[model samples]
Target chain A: MIDLFLFGIFPYIALVILIGGSIWRYATKQFTFSSLSSQFLEGRLLFWGSVPWHYGIIVILIGHLIGIFIPSGVMAFNRIPLRLYILEGTALALGLLLMVGLVLLLVRRSTSPRIRRVTSTMDIVLLVALLLQVLSGIGTAVFYRWGSAWFPQTATPYLWSLATFSPKVEYVTSLPLLMQVHTANSFVLLAIFPFTRMVHMLSIPISYLWRPSQIVVWYRRQAR
Target chain B: MDVRAQVATVFHLDKCIGCHTCSIACKNLWTSREGAEYMWLNNVETKPGTGYPTQWEDQTKYQGGWEVKGKSLKLRLGRRLGVLSNLFFNPNLPIMDDYYEPWTYTYEHLFNAPPSSEQPTARPISKVTGKFMDIEAGPNWDDDLGGSPVYARNDPNLADLSDAERAALFRLEQLVFFYIPRICNHCLNPGCLAACPSAAIYKRAEDGIVLVNQDKCRGWRFCVSGCPYKKVYYNWMAGKSEKCILCYPRMETGQAPACFHSCVGRIRYLGVLLYDAERIEEVAKSPETEMVAAQRSLILDPKDPTVIAAARMNGINDEWIGAAKKSPVYRFVKEWALALPLHAEFRTLPTLFYVPPLLPIAASSKRGKYDLTDGEFFSSLEDSRIPIRYMARLFSCGNEEIIKTAIKKLWAVRTYMRAASVGDISDQRATSAMSELGCTPEEAREIARLTSLPRWSDRFVIPPYQREDVIQQLTSPIGHKAQVGFGSNVPVRRGP
Candidate 1:
């Protein structure tokens, strides 16, 4: 029954909250769709925490997308023992790096008076959930071992099964307790996403890389 | 010809007394709010000394303004990529110490102090920290310290002068300084506009006053480091950026900005100046040495038939055009060429012009009975107490020729006026001097009136910024006219 609720009803709820809440925020309070940087007030730790955290999470996120979205391809590649080991090693290294960045950031927030003053209650929740989620994922990988090969058959099918309106708790109900917790927490984090500064994730300003610099918008209406 | 008229300003530095009445007026009007304690939209500083924010011109530290790379001007804080990289952290932003920890005296201490035989005095407390603290520095701490080696000797503009010349600056006989009253330059190419990630800062198409949309500002703080003049300030409490609005409230009502109106020296001149908007990009990209001339060339003759026709085509009415024709700023900055923009090397193409001060000639006792006066005002600037190199650095882009011409024209105008009124000097000599210095007799007479004896209306030719054209779109024009202050209608304060 619990598996049914976690795998079935919660995914849709998280998706609805994530999409609906973000659109509402952008519409009503467009200015708040920002990172709201505290680096100007306290910077030295951000240099160490932010740079590694950004790059490491990006690698891990891309790995997750590849696993869930194109599982057949990922499984085909993971068939070879050498390839599986190489892929597993790279993923573990990134997961470790993400953990290090998270610890440093938490230390920075607690220690720096300026950053601590600006740090919101929602900010603490977001960081704590992220750290726990990453730790659980790392634990499941270490104890159970070889998630790359098994995840396609278990979790990927279960996730894909949710898309077809069929509640398939049977696929992952038998998995380890840590894995179950990891999956449940990820969905809850998604539900909490819009309520926290983590909403800044949606706005990366990636267009600025290619776009021409120094463009100013005018408030007037011109005839020509 | 995309002719749009910008309201320009000229500050005659010679007349400026550094009284800071302009600063006080601006403060009382605009920046007196709770979070805006540190802001001074208008401030006067003694030259040959560190300015308000202490070494603001040290671009190496502050990294404000643009950099000249060959023919083009680039932001000193890099292009879009660099801006995005530094978007999270601005290393170059000024700290409280740089601008002084804006303090107010705890006058209540005088009332609350324990009864004492000696006098009870109030102590200064930091407004930011709200704690008792030692009073360190202020907006103009180095005022009137012209000969102080610590302040005047540390000026960045003194780079052009030799060691001996710098040392001579503090000598009793050679001591010289001038008041440079500063406000936002309201440039043709504003760096603050470019650096704003939220697209909050913009120059008005109607009048070209650069302003920030307070609602849209997310306090990213790039604008603080973007403006080379250090005019843009961050409101830490409000989480937004603010700057000189050019008193748009007063301007909309066809009145001068508080700073200009309250100037004790009457050094300020405000008026509409018609310029070709199309030339802005090209002029901004001009060679570093040629930027000032290029910017000046952008200003179109208000009386020119072609300019008038183009301005009309663009919806500029006859009244604005008429104001441009009589604009005292246009006469000083364009026709007479007595005024030049401050720090053209920044390449922001600032519209505010300065009529450089003509210091008293450095009288040498060794020459004994040398003829001190050939009837030229301030002695041709060659024998001036203030270094020409310093003034050139301040006004021109280190071009001495431009400063010389302006000084000479000022001398000719002064001579012409003295002859007309005082009658100690002959009319023939004044006429000859005007002609020699490239100012015609008629031009000199006009300059004299505009500079010395301008009527209040003549000094400030405020144009009617016809908001009715824009306002009529939403509501009844008459109803809107009852409610003044253009942006006051909008939700300008921070939203919950």
Candidate 2:
């Protein structure tokens, strides 16, 4: 039952909804909120609020990348034995920071008349999804521990199976359902990447450093 | 770097009287804001003295631009290099406060004290509120660019005098300096457009105008630093960057850009030229010697039948193509066998062309100073002491070969403009389309004439975007959430 739910069912549902839904959102003309004025922050509440939350999530994401992408064998040879502990600690701190920041951001968005008017229902749900991921990741990292010699390598492969549509849940079963939910929300974010301002990440400006601040003048005269 | 249209500019330094009308015009049109009160986009400076932003050209102190080391082009300083080019130093970028002080005005004394009228009849006395506002100086304020306390010694044109002569000239305080006019280059390969991670800034396919789509901007300032020219400014108040729009709105109509229309010197021209877009990368990557070779191949002779055909497909016309083919401007800018990039080492292939200044006949003759003598209007053909001409060359190409060729490329613009004004329509089809679009026949004729001329400046008109297409794009939600298949009812488990 656990296998069916974690691997077979959850993976398939996530793949379709996260990936397919995002593509459709971008293609279809429903409700979009994009404007030049979105970056204006009227008060300190909004400024301090969003800064920490967004930063926390970014930090957590970086930790995850380092842990998953770096090969364990290479890490072992390099004598980097405390990698998990470091990542776990960072995840916990960032998770707490994220929650605090989210509370501030959400409160401002909700209570402030102007911000409330601008925010949509979807924005709320997206924030909630991120919150759930933060909470679950922090909870698992703090409560669960593997022996120093043995590293659990099943979570990522199980994730890959779901990504590829061949969900196998036996290894992931050891993980709390909350952890599965957290990972699942991450996929949802990925699916939405192309359809949101998140797409700004892919831009390339080759001459970013040399932009000068001067006026360019071109002249012409009457044909004489 | 496959630019559809070749955008270029030619500045006649000798013609500029430095009245600063152009700077005022641009400031009124754009940067009249509380935060931008001190920002002067086009201020002229005395070279040897402190400049407005204080030593902005000292790149050793403020590191910017790309440096090639074998194969890797890396960021010199900042977390972006150490952190996978994704993370960077926090946006609290080093500011003027770190270097100097900022000053502000206060008018509180008027209310605090009583003033006197008539032989000092008492009523409300005013004083300049002595609140010491910390005024932080910018990076380019030190070298005053040969203005104000001006003399032969400090002047670029007069830097060769004996030390004693230079001292005598300075003792007399005999030099007068004024401001220069400026605007966006809208470069062939715009740094701002390239640096945008979101690809929000785009160079128009038809006009080579670079613009930023406000709705698509995410407030990332990669373009701010990326542009070696620093033409792109960060609008901190708006959270988005802003730049000179090239007056596309005016261009769409049968008019010139505001700056050109309002210019007192009449030194601007507008025309079209064809270039191979695929060669930009080659020109950008090639060594100095190879770059000229690459560009020579790419600069098309618009009069050639094959080139004309290709240009026409891209919306260029015969009248314009013909004028460009015959244009001395074209030969000087491209074929002069000497047109070089302003800072070729920067790697951004800018399209603006500049003709270097002709050195004055006498090394020291201050002849023929003609004053309008009528309400601050005056010009002189003789005073070769002023280095405005040399300044123009400096702004365009910093190399000697390009400079010499540019000086010889005269009358190209004049001939083209004359040919255009008389209804020698460059592209008749475009003219007819202008008429169809509700423009007066006279306006259409002028566009045909102006565009056909082999010059780079002309009166401009704005083009129209597809309203329905833009509306649809604006109304759509970027990210949407919809329920899909069944929920995964996996049992909740605690960590072992």
- Tens-digit lDDT track for model 2 on B1-496? 2224444444444345555566676567555553343344544444334343343333344343444555544332332433224322223222323223223444454455565663432232111112344343533343333333432233343333456544443442333333334466666656566556545577766556677665445456556556655556644333455676665544544445556666676545444556777665556566543444455566677666777677666554444455465444354455443234444445566664433333332222235553323221112222323343333324432333444333333223322333455544354533443343344455434433433342433322122333332212222111111111012121211100
lDDT of each: 0.79, 0.47
Model 2 misplaced regions, further than 4 Å: A1-224, B1-3, B33-87, B90-180, B288-297, B315-341, B357-398, B404-496
lDDT of 1 by residue, A1-224 (tens): 77888978898899899999888876766545446565544567886787778778888989888889999999899889999999988888888888888888899889865566557778788889989988987887788789887788888888888888786887777888888888889898989887777766776655645644444333456544
Worst window of 10 by summed lDDT in candidate 2 chain A: A215-224
lDDT of 1 by residue, B1-496 (tens): 8888788999998899889999999888777764467778899999888887888877888887787677666889887778877665677887656777577887987889898898888778777656678877888889988436777788899999988777777776567788999999998888888888767678877788898876466677888888989999876544667898898767876778999999888999999999987887788777656766888899999999999999988877798899999898998888888899998888788989999997767644445554545455456565677778888888988888888889988887887888988998898988887887767878877787787888789889898866565542333223333222243343223322
Model 2 error, position B352 (Å): 2.7
lDDT of 1 at A89: 86
